[model samples]
Target: MTAVVNVFLKEGVLDPQGKAAHHALDSLGFAGVSDVRIGKQIIINLETEDRATAEAEVKEMCETLLANTVIEDYTIEIN
Candidate 1:
């Protein structure tokens, strides 16, 4: 099994890195963008064959340490 996780700041939260990137884009004349959000992806390989178990384990990982539950939202995709 493989688990793909995407973690990003929740709406209404400040994303300084994203803001800086957006500003730099504007400075470079990429004028179509109005907002920016930054996120991270984590890919994990599992020995388990069951999709449900892989998903549950990844969810636990995210809730426990991979993400800040208070400020970030994470999605897990099992393949």
Candidate 2:
């Protein structure tokens, strides 16, 4: 099974890195680039054959180590 985890800052949280990237784009003369947000993505491939089991394990991984719930949110997809 293949698992994809997407982690991103919660709404209303300031993302300085994203802002910097946006500024850089503007400086490069990319017009109409109004905003940018940065986030983290993790991909994992496992040997599990069960979809439900893989989802559960990936959720646990996100809650335990992949994301900071206080400032970020995460979602998982298994394929």
Candidate 3:
């Protein structure tokens, strides 16, 4: 099985890296963009083929280490 995790900041959180990217884009004449947010994707391979088990394991991984629960949220995809 394969698990895909997307971790991103929650709403109302500050994103300095995103801000820098937005500023750079504007400087490069991409003024149409009003905002930007940065996040991370994690792909993991698992021995179990069951989707439910994979999802549960990945969710635990996210809660324990993959994502900062206080400021970040994550979605898990199993395949």
Give the C-alpha miss distance for residue 72 in model 2, angstroms. 0.5
Give candidate 1 regions above 4 Å deviation.
none
TM-score of each: 0.96, 0.96, 0.95
lDDT of 1: 0.94
For candidate 1, what's the RMSD?
0.6
The superposed Cα distance between candidate 2 and the true structure at residue 21, in angstroms, equals 0.3
TM-score of 3: 0.95
Error of 1 at 25 (Å): 0.3
Which residue pairs collide in model 1, if any?
none
lDDT at 12, model 2: 99
Task: Kindly list the per-residue Cα lDDT of model 1 for residues 5-69, writing each as its tens digit.
Answer: 99999999999999999999999999999998999999999999998888888899999999999
- lDDT (CA) per prediction: 0.94, 0.94, 0.93
Flag regions of model 3 displaced more than 4 Å.
Answer: none
Which residue pairs show collisions in model 3? none
Stretches of model 2 off by over 4 angstroms after superposition:
none
For residues 5-33, could you state the per-residue lDDT of candidate 3 as single tens digits? 99999999999999999999999999899
Cα deviation in Å at residue 33, candidate 2? 1.0
